[model samples]
Target: MATLDESERYRILSDERRRLVLEILAERTTGIGLDDLAQAVTTRQTTGTDVGPGTVDRVRIALHHKHLPMLDESGVLSYESEVRQVEQPRVASERHA
Candidate 1:
């Protein structure tokens, strides 16, 4: 279960879109990337909103400029983890003087 603080961090997202995205991610083991996630939200005709349209652009802009950096900074999700294809650089145990 997500803590209130964890959930609250996403208040930047409107409730409707956040719920929509969570629904999609809930159905999948691997998470969707931002572009695909936007398409999923917007294009789902069953939903009452046009989440498939500007939401994608908004999500991309937010992730590129805001949300992702904040999430990364908060240690919620690592930027390196999102880049699955790239081998994450190992942190050095010590720095030389």
Candidate 2:
């Protein structure tokens, strides 16, 4: 796992979407699929708004192309890009501790 300096950690967590992703992952006991994660994020983000498939798709694409990779590289989470799965890394628990 890679080490993140304070500035890097702040940068990674600065985005509302990424913070939401971490929050969701913290509540899960197992890995979440990219599709499911996207839906969850979209639902949380758009609380009362009428959400469309396009909205979810846009979120999914951003997560896949940007956020997930950033989190994975920061050792904050484990992202299996090929399988489109996201899991909180074991090291993340220790880091938090």
TM-score of each: 0.45, 0.89
Deviation of model 2 at 97, angstroms: 21
Candidate 2 deviant stretches above 4 angstroms: 1-3, 92-97
Give the C-alpha lDDT of model 2.
0.93
RMSD value for candidate 1: 7.4
lDDT of 2 by residue, 56-82 (tens): 999999999999999998888999999
On the 0 to 100 scale, the lDDT of residue 39 in model 2 is 98
User: Which lDDT tens digits does candidate 1 get at residues 24-61?
Assistant: 65576665566666566566634685454566676556
Q: Distance (Å) between predicted and true CA of 49, model 1?
A: 9.2
On TM-score, the candidate that comes out on top is 2
